[model samples]
Target chain A: MRRFLKLVAIEWKLTNREFITIFFTLIFPILMLLLFGTMYGNEASEFMGGYGSVDVSTPGYINMIIAVTGIMSLPLTLAQYRERKILKRFMATPTKPIEILLSQFIVNILLTILGLVLLIVVGKIVFDLHFFGNFFEAIFTFFIILLSIFSIGLLIAGVSKNAKMATAIAYIVYFPMLFLSGATMPLQMMPQSIVNISKALPMTYGVTLFKGIWLGDHLIDYPLEIIILFSITLVFGGLAVKFFKWE
Target chain B: MNVIEVKNLIKKYKNFTAVDHISLEVEEGCIFGMLGPNGAGKTTTIECIIGLKNRDGGEVNVLGIDPNVDYKKLYNLIGVQLQETSYQDKIKVYEICELFTSMYENPVDYHILLDRFGLHDKAKSYLSQLSGGQRQKIAIILALISNPKLVFLDELTTGLDPKSRREMWDYIKELKNEGRTVFMTTHYMEEAAYLCDKICIINDGKIIALDTVDGVIDLADIDQVISFETEEDIVQLIEKEIKGINKIEKENKKLKIYSKREDLLTDLVIFLKEKSIKYRKIDINRPGLEDAFIKLTEKTRKVE
Candidate 1:
């Protein structure tokens, strides 16, 4: 436990020095919230599929923030560690390889929570955005979504040959989720075909669930989204653990 | 006591064997070297002994524990310095040191280790900010920080400049003086000659020769190199007259005679005097590890 905590602490210290990850995970989401908040004001504007801009889009952008944390931050760091044989170095010690993976999970989870808080605080202060419904449920739903997305990221991290390949994989998964999965734009505004495609995306389920909870939809109301999120988490998370490469 | 014992260790990758039934023992507190060319399975053997890779066949005992059975138990007793291990680029030296220190149940004072390796001043410097030699020093310090009874150093001085290499050699000797069992692998014959108490020459995934430093050199058969620059061309004359000339080569106006005979030096001088050959510089050079490695590997290659 001590070794695991120490690894988590070291991982945080190391990650804090990365400017790009900081920009995308923490700064970028807040910037998106501010941009949309300015353009669509506090009133329930029809610009966001009849929902107010700050009301629904801010939560969606917050989903994008967690997506960056999962898809980009997790895989890139793991791949870099593997590429540089940092994982192999730990294999020589008593510290098992799983400990490193767990530590990375802990560190990224903390960062995502911190980013979520900052996004909420910033939106409330500057844009008059309010969480109309259960805040605690939103946090719970965010964790489930994080688990699903991070498992997919871990799969990429496990299979990539190097850091460059991991980055390419991350971007390939990220851009689609960001633009089409209701993370950046509203799914209701899209054509039926794009909505159908969005329906197939895990991020779509994540955004819809978070948006529901932010606007006061109870957790028991969305059975399908909950099933999909938990299912993806179990499947990809298992594969990630089974196929994880230390070298 | 043997700190490490490997018997007929076989590591196969699909169809090819990386380590082919190789066996050796490293005695306690001795600097043992595994000397081989690339792809000779030196690294594979070390990895297996350290429990990083699994072996297909045979036994590996480190600190009286089978590494494959309980490598975690051996972790505190054995330390390994891999050829190209690295930390996160943004991590500071001291931070990495502390991280590794926390991994061990009982760690040596990293401050003293860092100062000894001349990295105390660079403790706050990030990994990317340090020079290659400094990074290598930190790697060594990290390996030793756990105070392991046995240490494995692979290609320890491969890319360093002469000064840094010499400094590393001195530090390795210091480790020996501190009573640590050191097992190292290197392609540099000079490094093996200077540091290794016993050398195992591996060729084509097998042990071709194992002996003390001088023993291996002596076993190479060509024991002495007699070279002289003659005003008169006597290459052909000496080749015809010298009874036990093992090999001979001529460059420009100088000639070298390599012989395994015990009295080749005396016999050569007598021949020179009798032939009235005016030799300017006559010197006898003892054969070293390089000559032995080439000869041993060549012999093994022929058998294969």
Candidate 2:
């Protein structure tokens, strides 16, 4: 257990130094928040149903951080380690290869939590964001959202043989979801065709579930969203485990 | 006692057999070397012994445990440095050392090991910040950090400069001196001759020769070579006149003669005097591991 903890700590330190992880997870979401908050202040807009524009997007921003770390950084790191034969070296030691995989999982989770906390703190300070949802409900949202999105990342990492393939797939999965998922823009404003496309994305449901809970709705308010998120987690996470490559 | 024992070990990749019915033993407290040309299955054999690859047939016993069945237990007793393995860019020297050290129940202080390689000052440096040789030293340091009973070093000094290569040779010898058996694979024949107490040459997924330095030299059954430079065309005359001349090569006033004759030197000197031909830079060369390796590999090819 101590060795595993050390692996996680070292993994965390390494993840924190990655330029892409630092940029997207730690800085990019906050940048988007400040930009959107400045453009559309906390005034209650009719489109948001008596809530401010920044308030509605704050929860969506949390999911955005998830996509960055889970889909973009996580898969690429794992694939690169395999390509470099670093995973094989670790296998020759007494330590189990599963420790390396689990360490990455824990480090990414910690990064997501860090990004979420920063967004919440920044939201409260800069835009005075409202939080009508209970903390118990918020904690529940945390695990399921990460499970659904990070599993997609894990699946990509499992199949992609190297960093190059992971990058290609990550972009293919990340960009469309980032723009059309209503995570970046309100779904009410987008055209019907774009909204239809967004429905195919897992992040779209993540945004909806988060957006629902953020606006003082109960966790049970969105059964479809919960069911979709939980199912994505199970299906994709199972595939990731089945097909993951060590070399 | 043998620290490692292999019985008809075989590994195949698809239709190609990488290791075929190979068997050898590594005795405790000695440096053992495995040498071959590229694509000779050296790496594959090492991978199988370390449990990185599942054997297609046969058994591998390392420190008295089957590597494929109980590799975790075997790993605790052996350390390995692979030919091509890398770490992440952000990891510091001591940090990775600490991570690897934590896995073992008893580990030597890596700082002292790093100092032995003259890398103590670079302990906090990131892997990306170090040069190739520095990183190579770190790879070796990581291998020895656990102070295991047996160590496996693949291509140990491949990327090091000549000076560092010599240093690593001494360090590897020091490992044997400290009663740890060292199993290494290297392309450098001189390295094999210098450090290995027992040398095994494998080619085409088979053990071509396994013997001591002089023993392998004898296995080649090749002739000692005598070469000299002379302005005159004496190749024909030497072949015709010399009774023991097996073959002769002539190029640009240089004559190279191969023969098993021990008295060829005396015969050649007397013949030069009788022929009234002058020769300069005459030298006799004894066979070394490189020559034996080539001859043995050629012998295997011819038999097949």
Candidate 3:
């Protein structure tokens, strides 16, 4: 247990030392909230389908931050570690190789939670964002979304030959997820064809579920979204475990 | 007593064999060296003994534990430095030491280790900020931090500078003085000759020679080279008249004699005096580890 805690602390320091993880997980999300909140204003606007711009877009931004951290930042680091034989180095020690993976998960999960808290704090202070729905349910859904997204990152890390390949593959998925999933641009403003396309994206479902729950929508209406997220989590998580290479 | 024993150990990768049926033993508190060319399966053999690779046949015992079956139990008793050395690039040096120190049942005080390796002042520097030699020192430090009874160092000084290499050699000597068993692999013959109590030479996945440094040199049977600059063609005379010469070759203006017999030099001088051959310079060069390694490996290749 002491060894595990030490590993977790070291992993935390390593992750924070990198600029990309910090920017995407902490800085970028807060910047998005402030930038979009000022432009769309806090007042209830018909432009965002009868909800205030800050209120409707806030969940999208939050989910976006989660996706960036979970998919891009976390997996790239692991792939790089493998490329550099850091995993192999740990395997030779008394420390089991699995402990390194567990520490990475713990550190990234903590960072994701920190990102969420920062977004909420900034939103509440600057935009007067109000919570109307069940608070616990939102938090639970956030965790599920995190699990779903992070599993995909694990899969990427497992199959990628190196960090460069991981980054390229991550960006290919990251940009589309951000722009099309109502995370950056409102899904309401997109064309019917683009909206139909966004429905196929897992990130879109995550953002929709979070937005619906945060604005007091009934949880029972998004059963399909929950099922999709859980299914992706299982499939990706299984594959990641099956293919992960220490060397 | 032997700390490690292997019998007919075989490792295959698909249709190719990486380690053939080979056997060796490492005694306690000895610096055992595995010397081989690049593709000779030295790393693979080490990997199998450390439980990083599986053998297809035969048996291996390290410190009375079966590495494949009892690796978890053995982990605390052994340390390993792989051929590739790396850690998290942004992690500070001391943090890496502290992290590794926490992994063992009983660890050496890494602070003292850092100071011992001359890395005390660079404790707060990121891995990226350190030079190649410094990074290699950290890898060595991490392996020793566990304070294991046995340590495996693969290609320990491959990328180190001359000064760092000497420092690493001194550290290995210190480890031996502390009554620890050290197993290492290297292509550097001088390193093996200088540091190893027993040296094993492997070629094409099979060990061709295993003995003390001088014992291997003796086993190669090419004891010395007798070279003399002569105006007359004396290769034919030396080959016919010399009693113990193994080979005689003429290169440019010099006659080179290779033989296992220690009296070959005396025999050559008598032959030269009898033939009235005048030589400008004569020299006798004793075979070292490098010569023994090449001869043994060549003999193996030829037999195959």
Question: CA lDDT, every prediction?
Answer: 0.89, 0.91, 0.88
Shift of residue A106 alpha carbon in model 1, Å: 0.7
Q: What TM-score would candidate 1 get against the native?
A: 0.96
Output the better candidate (1/2) by lDDT. Answer: 2
DockQ of candidate 3 against the true complex = 0.80
lDDT string, candidate 2, B1-304, tens digits: 9999999999999999999999999999989999988999999999999899999999899998998899888888888899878898789999999998998888899989988989999999898899877888888888887788999999978977898789888888888998999999999999999999999999999998889988999989889999999999888888889898788988898889999998999999999999999999999998899999999988888898
Per-model root-mean-square deviation over C-alphas = 1.8, 1.8, 1.9
Best of the two (1, 2) by DockQ:
2
Say which prediction, candidate 2 or candidate 3, comes out ahead on lDDT.
2
lDDT of 1 by residue, B1-304 (tens): 9988899999999999989988899999999999988899999999999999989999999999998888788888777899887789799988999999999988999999988887788888898898778888888888987898898998878888888888888989988999999999988899889999999999889888899998898888765888889767777788898798878888887888987787899988999888787887888898778988999999988886
Worst 10 residues of 3 chain A by lDDT: A44-53
Poorly placed runs, candidate 1 (over 4 Å): A46-51, B233-242, B247-253
DockQ of each: 0.86, 0.87, 0.80
TM-score order of candidates, best first?
Answer: 1, 2, 3
The positional error of residue A163 in candidate 3, measured at the CA in angstroms, is: 1.4
In terms of docking quality, model 3 is medium
Question: What is the CA-based DockQ of model 1?
Answer: 0.86
- Model 3, A104-188: lDDT tens digits are 9889999888888899899999999877779888988889899999999999999999999999999988889999999889887
Q: Candidate 2 i-RMS (Å)? A: 0.8
